[model samples]
Target: MPVPSPYALLLSNVMVREASVSVLDSSTSYWDYGPPNADTVVVAVHGFRGEHHGLDPVVAHLSGIRVISPDLPGFGESEPLRDLTHDIAGYTAWLRAFIEALGLHAPVILGHSFGSIVVSAAVAGGVEASKVILVNPIAAPALSGPNGFLSRLTLLYYRAGRALPPKLGGALLSNWLIVRFMSLLLAQSPDRDLRRWVHDQHHTYFSRYATRDSVVEGFEASISADVSQFAPSITAPTLLIGADRDPITTVDAQRRLVELFPDARLEIIPAVGHLIHYEKPREAASAIVEFLGDGAVAVSEAAA
Candidate 1:
């Protein structure tokens, strides 16, 4: 796939060495979009098994803003943590390291799906950010509740599959099955173009190794962590985007997040799925642009 050229931007990648963190091999890829002298910086984090390209639309919409999106450890071009700490704690440490390494201060973080949870955790832990945009953030309670027997068994299969050799797992679970499985999570009546966008993301962002690793580790962590406990500690202004029709992030769960955050704005996108950014990129992007405004109004007003 051809990567589109950015307008007057700087792009680079670096391998990060963090002794305290248990990662396979950590690397960071970044793009400095728009003007070099741009004041506001937007940092986006993709969801589980997702890469930087998954945030392309959001990046494009904020053309003049400085945008930096990176592939999480074990995803995209970055190497997996050597310690295989794929849990939220590990991911958070990685984020801190990445930010410190890059010298980004209180950036406006845009998180999608699992990424939203990660950022929320960061905020809960007292990590600082100018603002937060959570797109289809996983509702903690919904994910923790009991699932069907068959669903549990299917998850077990994936767990067992993870222990198998990577090559064997890839050969057994064809990309087609992956796509079909993902489609099940999407809105049943998604537009043709939106379906294509989802398909493209499946291929481009999800690597066989990274996908399996993330699923196994992420599921365990999501169920284990009490994210609701962290909500009150988040000091950064937050924007929570939810989809009424999303199978994963239910409306109730989104509301729970809103109630927990001391400062948050909720936007429920009707008839959209968890992939709200893809299904309603323009609307989603507009909401972000409006929240993180240009000059004039004080930070207080922009946050309001």
Candidate 2:
């Protein structure tokens, strides 16, 4: 059963379609939103354990820009790369290849959470982008901040999942109880309805991976590196929308991250956490619009 998106009304008029492209020997599934000929085209990368649907709320707010949100290799509908582990290096290479396949000249790029690390690495490694936006960016290493203890537990959880037999491991990793618990950890919103929806989204899509090994490998990439590692190498102007209450990356850490980039600014949103795309999409869209200028103005108007 598909849970209805609360933002459906807002996106009722938006043109959206499923699009696919061959990149690195995988047929990538992506959602193409807004005007095809729009001047502002954002290649939005979603976080770990998420598909293109995870970023749909933010897409709903951005009325004018063409946002191409893809299911990273091995996650959602996308297949795993033919001969690469789903680590930072593999994902980074795939992103660079994916963008090149699109043939868009220096399109604006955006990433959320784990996607932040991948995008940062891609830009640092020579994928061109006119501007960059990170939502709830994983600014610091997962094991080095206020949430270190939680991250450790998450590591152990993954380790246990990988240790089990393939069938058992996949079942354990995708268990509804565990998925809901993770959703509870990240959903800091006071609104009960919002929190429930966030949980619903996680429960529905969090475990839709190509394989257990790929998922664990992706988790390793997420925790081992962050946006800060590649920040200094990214020369383009960047916008980071941080949640003051984010459990995955503290606001203080995000502030520190902003300093690592030569031309980056941070926008802190209150009363939200790691799930900013689901809980505070409008705010995220507004920050992105402001950073993107005239080509992104329609999103500001739509959000307002």
Candidate 3:
């Protein structure tokens, strides 16, 4: 089977419009899809180093829901924060502002990888969301265990890379060869089409450096995060999706996350890695739509 383009798949389902919203001193770039007056409104947050388009695959599978995927500050077309760490607290504040600025009312917040941490923090910090969905939430220390040594080493390399001159550091961190190798190593899916699609995405989006400070700070923040303190305070219903084969955020960690939330359920996606949405968009979307309950509309007209 031929690899299907994620971008093409996304555009076929819903018309994506480029828009910008002012958040504090900076602005955020986002893609607005689906009907504006749809019954369900989903604000999807992409992972670290990911732009708004990163969630296109998942968005393609959703129907009758307004999906707003944003390129968080310092990524894609968004501007970086002037003097703030791209840490959980910082991102949580930004997310809160973004939601309020757009007048979202009890919308479902969906986050993948690093975005999961942001969503968790936002809810914990009292952002009013009807529900929260976390895909491959980072487990921090568990991510640095025996099976995660390579990832830890990579983080260290990023730290070193950040110390270099701007141009050299950007070039070193966004090297195409390195990005492709990392994508291959991280991909756990056996499907050739999905793997090829992931590789192509990495080549197109991952092998570029637009914000060095955000990359460095985001890496540090992810490693140092411990959401256990406030995760239990979240009042919104939560869905935690864990990839069984994920090397970075282990399934064990996701279970712990489930424990932290008062009203949260865990769903494990078998045989996939951290990039669950990229590898198994349909499955991920099904899990999310199911979790959303009666309010979610089924994808009756999806792109093949």
| Regions more than 4 Å wrong, model 3 | 1-10, 140-144, 226-229, 294-304
Q: Per-residue CA lDDT of candidate 2, range 38-107, in tens? A: 9899999999999888888888888678999999999999999988888899998999898888888899
* Residues 1-304, model 1: lDDT tens digits: 6333221121211112222222335555555555555688767888866777677655545545776777777667666666657787887877777776777888887788878878877767766799988888876643345433434665666677678898776654445676567755663434665575466567655653455666577655554454465678887888887888877656887787789888988988787887776666656767777787852211222234
Tens digits of per-residue lDDT, candidate 3, 126-238, equal: 89899988888775553446746775787878987888997888788888888888898878887787789888887777743357778888777666665555578888988
Every model's Cα RMSD, please? Answer: 6.5, 2.0, 2.6
Q: What's each prediction's TM-score?
A: 0.81, 0.95, 0.91
lDDT (C-alpha) at residue 266 in model 3 = 89
lDDT scores in order: 0.66, 0.87, 0.79
The segments of candidate 1 whose C-alpha lies over 4 angstroms from its true place after superposition are 1-25, 146-151, 173-175, 187-189, 208-215, 295-304
Best by lDDT: 2
Best by TM-score: 2
